[model samples]
Target chain A: MELFTLIDILWMIFFLSLMIGCGVLFYRLGRRSESDFFLAGRGLPWWLPAASVYATHTATDTPMWVTGVIYRYGMRGIWYTFFSAWCAISAFVSTRIFRRSLAYTQAEWQSLRFGGLGSELLRGWMAGWQIFMNMFILGWVGMAMGKLCNYAFGWPLWIGLMGFSCACAVYVLAAGYWGVVVADFQQGIIALAVIIITSVWGIIAAGGPGAIVSKLALMGESWRVNPFAFTGIFGGEFPFAWFITMMVISIIGGFGMGTSIDWYVEAQRIQSAKTVRDASYSIWAGTALVLVRNSLWAVAILGFYVMFPNIPSQAEYELGWFRIGFEYLPVGMVGFFFAAVLAIHLSTISTHLNLGAMYATRDIYHHYINPRASERRLVWVGRISTAILLLGSFVYGLMMEEITKWLIFALWIMAAGVWLPNILQVMWWRFNAWGYLSSWIANLGLSWLVVWVLPAFGLIPDLPDYLQFWALMVLGALIYVPVTFLTPPEKMDRLVKYYVMSRPLGWWGPVRKEAEWRGLLHMKGED
Target chain B: MAWIRRHWTPEEADEWQKEDWIAIILSTFSYIALTIGVALSLLMLAVGFIVLILGIGLSVLLFFVIDPKLKAVSSGYEKKQKEYLEGLERVQRWEE
Candidate 1:
């Protein structure tokens, strides 16, 4: 193991110690109640939680991946910004509904609205999938951290993986939700600062925006205009249909996946807000933060391309960002940049750990293993479960070497398995528990089957991975709709009360007599 | 009710403004401009592999000179934004 420079080593130690200190401080501060541990006592100001949510979601992989997308597709990656914009707006609109209901989890809402074995079954399955999705996300965080450590300190992948994961586990287990929130706020600021500095520096390094555009124009109009260009397996060499399919899958399927319960940190923040208006404002504020934060990273990646015209291929995009940071950044700025990277890794990893532990302790253990368990015992379980999940993630990180592709695959799986069923059940009351179960199983099963069987059968085209993902998603959704309708609808009363509260637009059943008698009738065309 | 409506406090106005779609729109546009400028630059450089391959020697020399200037300009804008927001806060305090 080659020893790092004194400057590098000291910088690393400083960040590591700071992270550990923050974790310890948060742990002591939040050890009072399960509510404090899990939800930060539900008293965090909108800005803090909103910032935390943005920071937690803005992973280190994001900039690098965005860079890769810009490198490969040019202008086409801009579409993703639009999609995210829509998702943000949608999230903002949904916050009012979520705030009014005041359910702890999306699954709880399902249960309250639609009681019986079906609701229970749906809740159990959704909870299980959430854990699985979180595990996958945690793995990606570990892998990204490992790559950064390898780049910065020449640490072995396993060492970096363990060091990062363990630190996150310690902080999250100790501080609980409060630690994650506070750390997220701090990290979010650091990440934003670093992104601004790096992107500006990168753009200047590349000879300014005008020069960069000129260079792109020279490469080929396709490179400048076509998003699908350079998207195929081996460059711009893939078939057209493949690219089309990938675009559809990533953009459209992404919307459904965005609505998943685990992905709703904004909703969590909104729900935790002090009042309805505060919650709504928090969502908008959070949306703004995400937009700004993501844009900053996007700029840096774009600037790097301009600076280093011979950008790394798509597979190496994430590593390329780190490489650029290491090679191009000024001497003192390197420390700051590395600090931001560490912040990104810690903020995301700790949030995942906290969330995963919530799933295990509240959704699983509290509900299934020991409903009568004391708050103290449940908190202990949360901490232990967080540590266990971190360890598992570290191990998974070791198994996986690449960060970007791993994240995309994990996201695809989540979109198909978790997001699809959960959204359908929530929005479409006609969707029964059996339908939910079957849809989830079929989606995952089909996605896996496509991955395994298509190549063997030569049915898989030499298209972009995104296209393949899109095709699979369409296939999966098509399969799900039929399966959903085939199954019986959930009984009325279990979900009727939720309908009354949420007033979600759809055919939910005849309005309750109580609603009619109390002059709460929605009217004929109210829906 | 008339007095409340006519002599509405500035704090109330600011609160209402936070909810205004106009603020969100302006913020979103600002975000978009920033994203486009950065994303386009990277896309150009990454896809312009042929130029890079041909002028590797020249590009290397050019990059060292260019990168720092970009950082300076970009950081300047950020600093301005920070100052502007701080100024707004001060003005609000003075008004109160």
Candidate 2:
């Protein structure tokens, strides 16, 4: 274990105090009302939420995940980290529509978009799933910190997992999203600054970029620098077909809400923006930073590879970015780097803590259990829920190693079969609640069979992940399409009201015509 | 008419048009260019500089084309947000 000097310890104490102080500072504003607590009174400028977005997604595991891919596949591995591009079209399309709807969460959006029992069912299912998903994310990310601490100081995994998360929960429980977002702004700036400094330091340590490039050429590994160095068309490790599938999933997926798992976190940011314009720009700008940061990390990982040359294990190589920071930085600065790592960990933890509580308090408690609840009572419930999620995450974190595979399967099911339906629900007027619900149900069974059961029994060959995505998509459509046609379309009046409010893009022709006919919306020329 | 519509009425902006399409296309291109360009540029490659410049240019064009339309839409929506919020509450209470 590396010894941290007194200066390093003091640095950690100072940053920790500053983060907790944000909770105390924002407590009054958060206590004022449910809106103030969860959404910063929905009055933030674009940059506030933008910073939160950048901070929230830059979790402790992010650099490791990025390092693993870049080290294994060279610069071409950047595509693996490109999934956040779902924000590209979403910034213009779904962000606009959802902002106009003024729904508190995607679960609430379901009720606004569809009517009757199916909408209610969808709302409850989504809220429960989101709450579970956020907790699961908290567990895994916390465990990542646990592992990192174990690597750095020989601390037990649980101590790192439980300690930092509890500290972050201070702000989340006290001031809700108000505390979370404000702290995130400071954390985001620190994380970005340190990331640039350490990465450049790493590049310099490996004899600078010029020497690194020349050395790679000498080693006959020059293709590692080429971003488009595909091994073959469809058969090799890095294939063109895989690239095409990734592009489609990343870009086209943006047309739908909840297409990427990141969308749910971003939905909160979208609603918190002061205007629809602010919301759109926040998502767009925030994701642009994410992409740029990934690229920075990519080059730094290349620097690490050139120096190490032949690391055999995935786990060891994945720690390359951290090693650069911990091993190379000046003595006093090591503490500062550790503080930045805490900032990254806290930013993610605070987001999930507040996010999971939102589902619990707003969608579950207030909507279903106590619609007549006071603002004070609701805020209290939010705090209580935050505490519950934190405690539950500890349990989830401890058991994470045993269940990592199953949870990953759960995440894949969320993305693959439901991806097209997610878009259709936003873009198509006749895509009823039943259709969407059935797709989720169909995908669960289909994903398990295709990914595990069938492969285990040797009924079918185990396919690559991209191929599994296609197979699930096609199989899911067969079930949901018939159910949609078999069931009646959503009520016209409801569709008309939704169209007048949201003005969503795509095959919304019939809804638009009905809205115009009812005089709820005017024709372009008439207006 | 200008190739890109800069000024939009709230009513006109509510409709999806070529401007929105242009913004989407440019935005996607910018993401691709910037991601690839920044990495290579950091390595001091000449081609990286060209791609990075293209990404910046595309981003600027995207913002100009879409910002006015978005502003119009936002102003219109803000006026109605109060009413929509009430509707949201009713749905939550199962009173609609």
Candidate 3:
């Protein structure tokens, strides 16, 4: 383990105190009402939440994963990170519509979109799933921090996992998202600055950009520098087909809500914006920053490859970016780097804590358990829920080691089967809550059969991940589509209200006419 | 009537028009070019600089095309937001 000077320890203490102080600073604002607790009263300008978006995504494991891919596949590996490009279209389309709907969470929006028993069931299920998903994410990311700390300071895994998360929960419990967003703005800047400095420093260490380029060429790995250097159309490790499938998923998926897992987090930022325009710009710009940050890490990983070209293990190379910061940065700056890691960890932890609490408090408690709960009572429920989530995350974090595979299966299976239904709910008026709900159920079972069950029984060869995505989508549609046609459309009154307020796109001709007949819609030339 | 719609009334902006599609296309291209361009540019490649510039250009055009429509939507929607929020609250309470 590297020895740290007194200055290094001081730097860390100072950063920690500053982050915790946000809770004390914003405590009044956070307790004013339920909206304030979860969304800062939904009155924030675009830039504040945009900064939060950037900070929340820059988790401790992000660099490790980015480095892992870049080390393995060179510049082409950046495409893997491009799954976030769903925000590209979402900023203009779903962002605007959802912002108009003014729903605090996607679960809340379901009841607004579809009426009656089906909508109620969908809402309850979504809220429960979100609560579970947030806890799972917190555990997954918290363990990543634990592992990093173990590598750096020789600390035990649980100490690293539980310690920083508990520190973050202080502010989350004190001020909810008020503290989270404010701290995120400060943390986002520090993390971005350090990321830039370390990347450039590493690039310089690898004999500067010019030298690095010449060295790669001499090493006969020039294809590593080319982003478009795919092995072949359908065969190689990095095939053109896989790239095309990813592009289609990333870009087209933006048209629907919840198409990407990040949408749930971005949904909070979307509602927190002051206006439709602000919401649009925030998602677009924040994700643009994310893509740019990935590029910065890609080059730094390239530099790591240059200096240590012969390393064969994926685990070692995955730590390339962190190793650059720890092994290369000057003595005092090592503390600064560690502090930025804290910033990255705390931002994500705080977000999930408050987000999970929001679902539990607003969707479950206030809506179902006690609709008559006062604003003050609701805010308290939010804090209590936040505490519960924090404690649950610790339990999940400890068990994460053994259950990692099953959770991975859960997240991946969720993506493919529900991908189209997610979009269809936004675009098609006839797609009811039953259809959307069925897609989720179908995806869970089908993903198992395709990915593991059939292959294990020798009924079929193991298909590649891209092919699994195709198979799941085709198989899932067969189930949900028939169910949708058999079921009646959403109530006309409910659809019209949603249509007038949110103005969704696609296949809404009859609803549009009905809305017009009811004198709900204003024509294009109307004042 | 111009090549791109730079002006929008709230009602017109409420519709999904060519301007929305144009913004989507430009936004998609900007992300691709920016990702590839920034990485290659860091390695000091000449093509990287060109692509990076193209990405920046597309981003600017996208803002211009979409801003007016978004602003119009926001302005119009803000007027009705209070009423909508009230309705939403009733729904949350099962009173609607």
Candidate 4:
């Protein structure tokens, strides 16, 4: 069969038209100012950001990643991917705090929280790091999109990367965050539709869910049906013990210890909401969308399991999502499936492009080079920055040989790298720039030692991924705490102001008392 | 010139001008409730495609009734933002 028949081609064209139309409709919404470009002028209603947050996260690789895990680990495997869900617990609390802080970017929050050369250094370092990280993530997702196209339709990887890159860049450049938000809402719905239909189709094709369960029963792996089949932490993805610890840290840090904390979430959607209440709702909305998205994939996996019950190796299991789509889906339905896949890719890449441009243009370029630059000039610079990010990701995507390895890199290394600093920056008032900088630097070195160097030399006997992750987090702490005490604390004036604005509940006891004494706050728990 | 610049103006207050407390409580709860309802219904359906009838029935019920009630609860605050000021005043007794 031809990869896409005429009807499928028509569906693809229709899908592309909607995406472009979404961009054009919102073209005027972000033209006037930097706020418009970065945060949709901070006038967005709750639902828009809510949809965008959920939409950007459900990228092309999300279903593939979900399927790969299920095929290997059964139902319990979802906990590995559902780590992002932990953010919702934190989101419920931070929305009030993030909206109140009013810092445009998370990097901008440093100067709001700290002062003197320490604040300056922290701010600059974080801005640069965020820009790099955003591009790196864009490249990561870009490569995944390329792999999907190559695997499903026999397209060359580089062409797939470049083609999608240009399409996303054009829409992103057309309207800034406005375009990104509108496109996300539309694309999120379309992608959700595709999943709903395909998942149901897959179920029907497999003789329904009963047949799937019966087949698994015959294989003597009935345990696969249960979601809580938590076999053991020692063997699976993240040793059970370490996974619990990580969850504790994630939840504690996300919600902030005791008081509400923002954790400098890179989600621009949160900051774009019209009110703190709106921001809070957006997180819940996003989390709900994600959970449903996963459940839909679960239904499809039931069909997938029925089709291929025994796999020779992990490679085939990971390719389960692709094989099911290519082999089982009906002719025109297959085209819509690919369109959905492309929709997923485009939505994610567009958000990253807009966010990266916001950081590069607002936080770095205009902040340092031309503090007084016109809104028009900054908008133009934003467009240019989006183009640079697009090309940069395309080049990086071409070079990446596999998506699974990068998955490990993102989950284990990057999570550990930011884990301590993100929590400490909010919880510990004494954690100065030196400490923050040291923690990240230490995390990088220690993570490298555990993840790469030790294993390569055969000195550590090739540790599991979870053990490597635990070592990085523990060692990161051992390095950063002493560094914090060694360095002087952030200046007092900065602390007092930030305390009054955020009313952050933490070790800021002294500062909180001071604010109370001065009547800057009427009473405790006012937030 | 240094590579760092502070865009966060200290002179400008970061105090978020809050929406009416009635609006916030109304909006947040409605979404949470509706979401949970939908999730449970879907879970029922996913247990077996045979139960998809139950799933479809529940989803339709949620869409027709639960979803609209949430809208009414939420938009009631927005539409009646002024009339609800007394409720907002009581909420402000506790909140910022």
lDDT at residue A172 of model 3 (Cα atoms): 91
Q: Which pairs, if any, clash in model 3?
A: none
Write candidate 1's Cα lDDT for A299-341 as tens digits.
4555555555664556566565676677778765677777778
- Order of models, best DockQ first: 3, 2, 1, 4
The lDDT for every candidate, in the order shown, is 0.59, 0.93, 0.92, 0.66
Relative to the true interface, what fraction of contacts does candidate 2 keep?
A: 0.82
What is the C-alpha lDDT profile of model 2 across A1-527, one tens digit per residue?
35589999999899999988976699889988888878888888999999999999999999999999999999999999999998889999999998888888899888889888899899899999999999999999999999999999999999999999999998888899999999999999989999999999999998888887888899899999999999888888999889999999999999999999999999999999999999999999999999999999999999999999889999999999999999999998888999999999999999999999999988999899999888999999999999999998999999999999889989999999999999999999999999999999999999999999999999999998889999999999999999999999999999999889998888988888888788888876783
Interface RMSD of the predictions, in order shown? 16.9, 1.0, 0.9, 11.9
Give each model a TM-score.
0.75, 0.99, 0.98, 0.82
Q: What number of clashing residue pairs does each candidate have, in the order they appear?
A: 20, 0, 0, 1
Candidate 3 chain B lowest-lDDT run of ten: B87-96
Which stretches of candidate 3 lie above 4 Å from their native place? A523-527
TM-score of chain A of each: 0.84, 0.99, 0.98, 0.92
Residue lDDT tens for model 4, B1-96: 122121322222232212122223333333333333332233343434433344345434333332322333233223433333333223212222
For candidate 4, the clash count comes to 1
Which stretches in model 1 have alpha-carbon errors above 4 Å?
Answer: A1-16, A80-83, A218-267, A311-317, A402-410, A417-422, A449-455, A458-488, A509-514, A517-527, B1-96
The TM-score between candidate 1 and the true structure equals 0.75
